[model samples]
Target: MALRTLFADPMLRMLVAAVLLAALLPARGEARDTAQLVANAAVFLLFLLNGLRIARRDVLAGLANWRFLLPLILFVFGAMALLGLGLNALSEPLLPPAIALGFLYLGALPSTVQSATSYASLGGGNLALSVVSAALLNIVGVFVTVPVFLLLGGSGQGAVGSAVIAKILLLLVLPFVIGQALQTAAHSFTARYRHNIVWVDRMAIAIAVYVAFSGAVEQGIWTRVAPQAWAALLGLVAVMLLLAHGGAWLTGGMLGLPRADRVSFLFAGAQKSAAVGAPLATILFAPEAAGFIVVPLLLYHLIQLVVAAPLASRLAQHPAGDGDCTAPTTTATDRSAPPR
Candidate 1:
């Protein structure tokens, strides 16, 4: 049994951490605030590494597949906007309608580096595509999500904070482009030192945790968000998860994509990139509303990780879990195994 768990696939861990983090979010205090700070920093580092590893040509290639990935991202964003509208109408006592709705905004942002690639690896897909997809979203989200945020959220000038644009450009976008450049120039170094580069991933996660949790406590996250509200958020996460995963799988499959592509779609389509997106909120919105934007991202992150991991393991066993429609496949393609 010990060996089984030790050998157990890593993909499931994402879902576990997602639910756990939401459950563990700091409730309006210093501790939470401190944690939030750490988390922010951690995510930043991860973004840099993600940027550094990107291959320029791959990103260009992803542009070619825009018809496939872009529409899915838009659909997620649109659904979030519409969901926000509903939550706004309901206007529950617990629901800070704007914030509750903003959670939907968080949902729409897009998938991230660590988990998306990690899950792709678990599900036995294309790691290169996973990296490109995540990097593209981080770059494009600067323009796409921020505007949608303002539109759906209505001039949240002070809602998140000041550095939204800069942070996205610098921490997220700039690093990715730079990384791609580095990938080309330092091809030998990156290949030689790939193992060492993962330290960057861990550092980013640590910083994100400190910053997010700390801020939650410093601000009135507990009073504002509340337990019941969290419950509602969890329910919303499950629904979104189903939709994103199902939508991607069905759509990709219908397009006659091979199993490798389908696996990539399911993981990428379903998961949100909290690591990248959460810190972006800190830069964009108010300290108070930071928790709100991040809440959805966090929930989505955990759910996808835990859920994606198991599904990945299962799919690994069955390969074509899709049944009679099962297609014989070649060797595993893009498997994203990020740092433990």
Candidate 2:
């Protein structure tokens, strides 16, 4: 049943397909250039839709809950990022430098708005808070991830300079700002067709992955990375997952959060956003290096989904309440829709 649930995710299947397709027939020369351009456009559209969908009121609500939000931000970007640095140092001897650096990249990423909220809902968490917190984390991620990555010593083949900052502002931040500005006019349309629009997110991520992996393949990634290195990488990722989930849960308890909020924190603090990570990698790294840098994130995303399903099921069954572990009630106007 767990295996079925995992495979049933279309986004997951799309990502796997993207990786396999890149391996079998990676774009090169003119094709590579064309694919990169398409990926860029897709990323812009994706962020624009995010800005349209995330209500300003929700942002304010999340901000108002600073006690909950502050810790979460610190955990996702601070403690987790430091953990990534440790993992990178440990894995340096075992894996290639770029792939090892992926640990820090993964650590620095934001929580997944979709998966975190979905699983939080499934686990009988505070759905309203889950949606708002995860959305805000993504918003914060766009601004903070690059600086955090660089501060923690993450750099790709391409130098991060004025050009890169301009690209991020133009392709990512600017589009989101445009969406926010147009939100009053487009909110109804975005709300009405959100489920359909999830495809845009998935497709953008897939395209970015395909492009990054294509360059890696062109550079002979398979030959450069050894089988033993793959095993070491998986082992390291598992350790990081355990720490992420356990640490979040423990922190929530230490802070005396209600069970429902704890559930929300568990998922929100632990999961990383491939939606943000993949596209941002393309912007930050050269194509060949971006592929290796994203490898850890891709693997972590898959494993988290598999783990979250069963964990959520378990939590749902044992709603040992400091209060009922069901989603909090909120009106449509006040509630923020979780992004896919």
Worst 10-residue lDDT window, candidate 2? 328-337
Query: What does candidate 1's lDDT look like per residue over 286-310, in tens digits?
Result: 6555545566566566666546555
Best TM-score among the predictions, by candidate number:
2
lDDT of 2 by residue, 47-79 (tens): 999999899999999999998999999999999
List lDDT for all candidates, in order: 0.60, 0.89
> What range of 10 consecutive residues in model 1 has the weakest lDDT sum?
328-337
Candidate 1 Cα errors over 4 Å, as ranges: 1-45, 76-93, 97-99, 124-128, 154-163, 223-226, 318-340
Error of 2 at 271 (Å): 0.3
